[model samples]
Target: MTLSVQLRHGGPPLDFAADFPDGRITALVGPSGSGKTSILRAIAGLLPVRQAHVALGTEIWAEGNIHRPTRERSIGFVSQHYGLFPHLTVQANVETALIHLPIGERRKRALHCLALAHVEGLERRYPDELSGGQKQRVALARAIARQPQVLLLDEPFSAVDRSTRKRLYIELLRLHEQLAATVLLVTHDLDEAAQLASHLLLLRHGRIVQSGATSEVLTRPTSEEAARLLDIPNIFTARVDGTASGRNLRLRWGPHALRATGPLPAGIEGDLRWAILPSNVLLVRPDKPWGSHLENPLLVIVEEVIEMGTEAVVRLQPQGLSEARLQMRLPVRAVHRYGIAVGREVTVSLRAGDIVPLHTGPAR
Candidate 1:
């Protein structure tokens, strides 16, 4: 199924086309108001668009003048808030989706779905009586009771605790494999998207900035907006002082010089935006000399270290330069072994290959 959308409702229009492979999970990821949920709603026909087209293997659910209602579209939508009725038990909620069937068939279908969602034992419990994860399971089970061709999940795990959410991720993956329904998940959590989605769509301000395989999109963001939204912190605006047919240009950031690779327009000079992931920031051994001794190594003062489980986010202030504060994500084991702490001087390296040029500006 390929979902092509162009929508406008007195706001910035959304105009982007993407294909959701049949029976595969595709995540719509972006910051709030980026139209992630709107896109899902549009697909479900709950939110009509000025111009939209949805096709599932040659069957058009929606198109110009041929719009299908939400129920007719046959999409199972699980909202972020877990729209489970407080008064209804888990079994009743699942059975509600199958009301069109006979009473006996509804009970059978609900039980099947509950088992598939791994919440079979909680069938008699009300929404309030269940844990956050259990409530989500009931919601998912209810959504799938209809056996819809497409499943739309709008941040279904966002409300749960981290540990609970992790468990749900595995459960969802299991259910996805068992059900084999095409899924479109709306979420702002990139890690969640990367973990569960085989494909990714990057949305921004009602536009599809990029879409591709999960690994490819994360490793190679197409623009500054994409990189920034991905939470990549090592972005910089460097003046291009030299170039060789737009390959390996010499760039200057503050008083520091660095090398950049990739094709740019010939004679492309002046300031250009570049970014690198914090994980790529390497620490130079103290035994080695800094400066001209290494290609991109720079002496920096450790301003702060934020412990994050097994890894730490270390803020490095480059010495003898006016560059912005840089952050490096290093293993806690390495940090402790090297006795790295606040105010300690250390050498850090950013490989030229790691520094990616953005298709956007240098916002000087």
Candidate 2:
């Protein structure tokens, strides 16, 4: 069953509608105070809104003058803090979710859930006795003990260490595969969203800026604002010079002319914002002189190179530009092999298909 929601409020204003597909993970991501958590709370009936409509398939959870209580929503919620009862043992915490079940069955069901969450041995411990990761696992067990139809995770891994978070991600994916529960995950981490969610919703100031398949939204933001929010650093304003061929268009970026694939807005005139993903910008190898065959190859000076463990972020300034810079991400090995350093001249290729035009004109 798909989870559908429409919400509106005045203060801290939220006005957006979204549908979370069944058996798929849809991540709601944005900077802090973007209404990501508010949307989740509204859907789970934990927050009151002026106007809202929330439904799981044909079952309406909230609508005009009607709202169901949180308990009746059949959702498993894992808040950022894990929210485990301080006084309750791990097994008891999970068993609370099974209160509606037969008294004889609650213990067995709770134990089963604990085992499913990989915390069976720690069931006798209280929240204070458990590590952050262990507490998170217990919270997960408790959340799923009742076998909820929809899972609501609000930055569930944010409190854990990086290695623990990665392990939990795998566990969550595995559990989702087995249960096929519809999940709406709220997180600010873009990498986490990309790794876990198939669908993505980019929220900002209580509004949805974009929504689509994760790859599509991440690689091809529809607006300059969206691209900026996604932290894409290679946006440029370019003029539409003319058509290059049947499938390509010529764009003039300052002194440089670039070829880009189109479906550009019809009758589009003047300049528009365009962007390319850092990973899509290719560094030309000295051994292979195939830059001649590439669509957009430019000789640029390496302005800065930031080494980040196995990867490096290299900033390149095109030869004749005043302050414009293009950023590219490459493996650390490639950085050493190509001798990419500050103030060094280098050649980088920008594929026509990878250059995404943000809009035909100014974003509405």
Candidate 3:
């Protein structure tokens, strides 16, 4: 089924268009207060649509008299806090939505959901007694017990620790595939959006500024406004160098010169800013292939290296007077094995294929 939702209370408006394509996870990604939650409420009939319409398949929830109440809509929503009842047992919370069902069926369905959520043994546990991850799983169990036609998640892993959050993300993806659930998940996390969604929608100021295939939106976003919202680091200013209908730009960051694939707008050639990602940069021996889309190559000095468990973030201070600091994530092992320390020189290649030109600003 396809869902198109548009809503605005005051100030700016928010719009989202995408299909709940069968057996795929579609994510609604943006910064905080960007109308992600409002979209959820509007779709569930819990919020009023000011000047927009919401359509789910042939049913129009925000148009005409076709509105379906939250209880009537077959949607299972899981919020960031995992709103499980404090006084209720795990099984009770999971089975709460199934109140209309007979006792036997309700218990059966609840247990099945708990098993899928990997909370089977915690059936007798209370919300307060459960860990953050466990509570979220129970919240998911409750959602799936409703046998919802659509699943809506709102930053479900945000409250947990980094380790638990990663595990939960994997589990969520597995569950989505196992059930073939149509999902519309809301997150302020870029990594979550990149890893979880097949399609991405970047919202800002309550408007859906950009939406497309995850890579397309991330790399070649539609607007400067949308680029700022993606939190893309190291976006540089540059101009088109060659004649591909201005479909190329010569960007200069600090003393580093780079090339971009898209046509630079008029007056932006050599005088405008370009966008690059720290993570997109490759730090290695200068002899290694610089991938396919090669751009500016820099022999940078490792100014600082932060060992962040699984990954090490290396800060590179490029040559010359350009006051730009380039950062790249390398595995912990790579940092340790290379004896890559502060003041060590490394050749970092900022390839064109890795370039995502988003005007001249970082993604918010």
Model number with the top lDDT = 2
- Taking all chains together, each candidate's TM-score versus the true structure is 0.89, 0.96, 0.82
Give the TM-score ranking, best first. 2, 1, 3
Clashes in predicted model 3: 22
Task: Return whichever of 1 and 2 wins on TM-score.
Answer: 2
Q: Residue 269 of candidate 3: its Cα lDDT?
A: 44
Model 2 Cα shift for residue 104 (angstroms): 1.4
Question: Worst ten-residue run, lDDT, model 2?
Answer: 355-364
Error of 1 at 49 (Å): 2.4
Kindly list the per-residue Cα lDDT of model 3 for residues 1-364, writing each as its tens digit.
Answer: 6766656567435644444565567778777778888887778887776665776677776775567678887789898798899999999999898998999999999999999999888999899999999999999999988878788898898899999988998999899878777788898888888888888778766666777788788776544666567765565554445444456555665556666665344555445655566667787654456564545678888888998878988888888745677778888897887788999888877766566555443343
Cα lDDT tens digits, model 1, 189-208, are: 99999999999988887777
Cα RMSD, each candidate: 3.1, 1.7, 3.9
Per-residue lDDT, model 1, residue 327, is 91
Q: 238, model 1: CA deviation in Å?
A: 1.7
Which regions of candidate 2 deviate over 4 angstroms? 244-247, 262-267, 360-364
